[model samples]
Target chain A: MIKIAQLSCGTEYSSVQSEIEKAAFSVGGKMVYPDVGADDIDAAVKEFGFNPRSPQLKLMIARAVQLAKGVYDADAVFIATCFRCAEAALVRNELRRYIQEHTKLPVVTYSFTERMKSAQLLTRMEALVTIVSRKELLARERQTGLTAGLDSGSSTTKALVMKDNKIIGKAWMPSYDVVESATTVLNQALEQAGYKLKDLEAIGTTGYGRFTLGRHFDAKLVQEELTVNSKGAVWLADRQKGEATILDIGGMDNKAITVRDGVPDNFTMGGVCAGASGRFLEMTANRLKIDVTELGKLAEKGDWRNAKMNSYCSIFGIQDLVTSLGEGKAFEDVAAAACHSVAEQVYEQQLQEIDIRRPIIQVGGTSLISGLVKEVGSVLGEMPIVPPDSQYIGAVGGALLSSGFLM
Target chain B: MKKIFIDPPNSMILFDIVERLGHEPLSTMAALQERVDNLEIDMPPMNVTLDDVISGLKYAGIEVPSGIRGRLATWGPHIDEADAAIVMAEAPYSFGCVGCERSNEMVKYLLRRRGIPVLWVEYPGDKEAAMRMLEKTKEFLGGLE
Candidate 1:
């Protein structure tokens, strides 16, 4: 059997995995789905040495490392990309160059838009598999060892330890000081795994505070937070069967990532300088004297079809919300309107150009709020894939990077 | 004196008004003209570049060609220098070049993100709206002094 390892930017190709697998099987190629465990993410990062100032490019480097690992035993690799995504467009050449140089495996990249037909995709996959199967299978020679990945995000720090391609321990904490928070999580994971820091083969770091934490930990590699999130989303969703889009709504920023064949093809983000973000929701919830958790439930109960919040600016949105509430409008309706407003802003500002292919995988803390998910779903007209551990995806991807599951 | 960036930088009327008010009207065309004048090219080169193409996509969220970048580049220095902006929303649709819809949208978006005070007006269909817009533009620019 032709052993082909598949790697992608997780949520981008969530539902498309089955089609790829079918195409592989039809061509007498057995697909090797890498365990979503652990590998030396830091080592991978060091191998691809591009220090990008842009957060998106930085994350692409991190993801490139993981996807490169997926090429280890495969006859060929397929990278799903989105054409309109500025970050993906910027890093595409670099990623292809790294993979070709390091793995020497045949890599096939294609973009999937709503206009792309399944038959066309299957035909392309078949052709690639057929062409690559004639090549001799590469043997796997590396041994599994304990590795760790640390992700120090803007609001939290997460750590994961993997042994023999299996996740043994994971921990997270609210982040204040990057080093302290990272250390706390690392220690917690180490305790859970019953291993000393000295025993770990290598360490990788990612997230907003990656540079700081990498230095403090003397981390062997550093990855981008967005790439880690994409990797984690792919693993969590069990290799999405078709075109998948990852909508990660974080505390201050929102990201829309579309994956073609497990690689981020296109992506857009909001809230860099200003726009609606999770903090906006929190503030709005607080003003209504409701817990952030309750905003979703209230939205579900309210009939807010006509309630429109016109402003894309969070401050303006809040002002509108305040005025609406003061006008004796139903609190639930107003809450729903807030959710709708955010959804509209995301769609208009970020996703207006790209053709969003479903099933959309909703990740990040805000995704947990059912109201926001419902609002976003209504706007896209498709329910999103919300994993139980959505909030921990970034850290999980970081850990996975260390474990070799994601390279 | 305040520097005010005007959309449809080719609008001679808007440019004249800004000059009459004793403010510098920053226009994209002026920037291109300055570059052309400085270079003294035998033939006027296209104003666009790869940087503008990318910036149009990144900053303005519009897909445009290098040619459009040439025109957009003229507005950049003014955007940086301007104390305020006056946008005639329908100017591009009416009197200005309508070949690139994306470029038009991009210019508008860029102006909004400049974080400077901006006065947006419709292309006046009647004398009343035109007078109101003129008053608003003068008042807005006058305050910059």
Candidate 2:
């Protein structure tokens, strides 16, 4: 059995301790607490640079020191703490960084509450297992066989066909019912590529509708969007062999991920609300009486400073735009303001979660909007790479990873 | 007799019942009274000093938000001294909001982690639920030595 280190505080008292162990066990992992000598009690405080009243947290740091020193044998690490305790949160994040720097073991950090169940921890544990147990597959540089990938996103569905490391066919359309949307894009892409579903060696599904689509297609790989998107991003941006940060500003939310050598080490996703998303930009375009695509060109030409909008609420944001236009501001400037507002909100709310690396790759449908892309660059002070076919990222990511399952 | 820790420390139901059971109930109101009654400080507001808040670092980190630090400073040590605890979870906010969830979760975490006997019951929504809560409380307190 693969040994996965459980370095955490506060779970033993909470109802979720057994739940964590069960989740690990379900994924063929054994959760082991690294034992430390009683003598190391004070030494842990000195080494870890913090003293907590909880002996459990103190012992946790000592165990981390032991693991970093190679005194323990483990394939992966799961670092967790109670969501309520600020001290535990600090220790958990610091331990994650320390372990990642000291060892090559895959690490996943989580802050949980007393109400959390095992089901919530399962996918995280499964991802750690997948990263450790299938490193070779994830490390595979190029696709070698016929594989199909389906991405069922919030606002759109995408399907792609890949062969010999090259995308042969792809289709993007508005999302409808989960299975119907997936089937529609899958059929379109397959027909365009002149390949039948029977000809595919393996299939992978990802995005919001992954569970339903994976079941419908009997997919070989049903992976979360975090892993898939990172894989797809690095592959498309040619940053697979290096470290980079990924920014996918989606329709309903935003995701900021920091990756190392194409593997996602840290992932965070959320937005204040839909106000900081592409739907807001689309709404801005409608208010400006222009297509979403035209807003980009207009934004590039006009200055964002000329039109000011707050991304706190969509209604309030639109009102700002209307007021600006009533003040006789150009549509170009208003479009620029809309993109910049979304970018600023994303930078403020979402990007604060992860450490941004070089060559930040912006994917998802919004990445194609030149205005949003420029505004993101201005806000981040670093130009992001919008790789070719960026919109097909989820589909490509699913296809690329699932291709490994092909025999 | 055993000391019973009640959350919010202001719940009359918990305070009155635990007191009737012939045990000291560690309620915030009681603890605050003891602190404020001390004639050492000159301030009429009964406010704590900066030195007092930094002391909470033993319980939480310095990075913890200021408000939570203040709460933990006053309650953390008290929770440590608890032999047994009775927590009424999710008290309705409209009629009477018992305590902030963040405070409740933190206190419960500390109380439960000590391996102390804890009687966890939800705030009663009806007479039936109230009766059940009372029965559980009686059984739990009675079962304790």
Candidate 3:
């Protein structure tokens, strides 16, 4: 039986992986559905270089490196790309080139859109499986070991320690420097688990600062932000039998991920709009000269239904707040408006068209803010499942990847 | 010769029209490209750093950074240098690159604040509109020269 590795956005990975698995089984081939947690992040960054403008694109480059390393022992590789994702579209060709150059494995690419039918997906998967099976590839035994997953985000660094397929300890801290913060969080988790770094078999890193932390820690694996988030959401929600949409409002970006059977089925990310992110709330609170922690409480006291500040730009929105204040609008009202605006921005721009199933799982640090959560709930018409320790989902997923759970 | 700033800096038609009228065509894309080339640095389209956002807001005389400021900074230098301006109200929307609606509004706001002769043209949706646009654009460019 041929062993094939799959690479795709976390949102669509589960559904797409299932179809690929069905096809592979039919074609007498085995599928190696592992998260792209391979030790090639640094090499890929060196080869592709970095584009500071699109951090998402840089993550894709790192993913390509992971895939390159992943396919080293596999017979073939499959890359699934979301059709409307601009970042994915921009990086697809380069990712293919990198994988082809580094590995001799046959590579196949499929673009998935919301409009794509199941038959179309199955046909492509079947063809790829048929071709891969013809190569007579052999399956490798799964590796077993304790491992750690670290998430070094722009605002915070998180670390998770996993032993015997269970979370032993996890820690998170506000990030100042990538290396220092990541090490601090890792040490905390390690101390909780009563283990040293040498006790772990592998360390997988993810998130905005993943590349830097991966290098510093000599991590054995590095996964994309979306993939790690999806994995972590599934693990946290314990929704192994059902599908749920994961909404993550990070410091700089917002993501809406669709997960089915503990894997991402489809996902969409907010465009370059700070108003749709946590930064908007932070900036607005700063403009109001109020603490960010207090803004949520103030918003709870105001009438958000009547408070609508429709400015789509965060910079311009601050002016709106100032003008509202000058016009004798209550501070709580302005705070409420800011929260609603952020939620509305994300909903209208990113999640409006997505077919959101039941039980939306909200993750990321911003999810902890009551006002933002309430506003987002209003937009979705359903309360999102904001899991305890929601911000650590990505790191937990990274830990899961490190433990070779996805394999 | 007059220095006429053109919005939607990628519009070769407007650039040609301005140049044919014996005026210098100033555009944000040209200024930005010049800066990028001079530094021999690669800049992804629509990518803005916090510093770029701050500088753009500063250029626009706004004390805060924003998406508008970030975008305005790209063409603010050229806009500052121009003697007059021609704005395509619908051109940026057609190009599908001006993702920020506020930035689009800021361009017009900044141009008006410059206290220069500004020509506002709606991008043609039909042949009749196209003729009218060309005629109005020619009249505006001719007046500048």
Evaluated with TM-score, which candidate comes out highest? 2
lDDT of 3 by residue, A212-297 (tens): 87888888766557656777776777765577889999887777866556554445555466877888888888888987878888
Q: Is the docking of candidate 3 incorrect, acceptable, medium or high quality?
A: incorrect
Please report, as a value between 0 and 1, the fraction of native contacts recovered by candidate 3: 0.00
RMSD of 3: 15.6
Query: What order do you get sorting by lDDT, best first?
Result: 2, 3, 1
DockQ list for all candidates? 0.02, 0.03, 0.03
lDDT of 2 by residue, A23-96 (tens): 88987888998888767756876887877655556777888888888998888888877655667666777777
Preferred candidate (DockQ higher): 1 or 3? 3
Clash pairs, candidate 2, are none
- Candidate 1 residue lDDT tens string, A1-407: 76665543311111234445666676566656444222343344466765433332344455556556653355655555343444444355556557665664555554433223344445335434534542221111121478788877665677888777566888887789888888888999999999999988877787778778878877765655555576667666755345688898877677776665445544555453244677788888899998888998998777566465778777788888888887888988888888887777788766753447787889887887888899898888887889867776776665555544333
Candidate 2 DockQ category?
Answer: incorrect
Write down the DockQ of candidate 1: 0.02
Cα lDDT, all candidates: 0.64, 0.79, 0.68
Pairs that clash in candidate 3: A10-A264, A11-A264, A11-A265, A11-A266, A12-A264, A12-A265, A12-A266
- How many backbone collisions does model 1 have? 31
Winner on lDDT between 1 and 2 is 2
* B-chain TM-score for every candidate: 0.79, 0.88, 0.78
TM-score of 2: 0.69
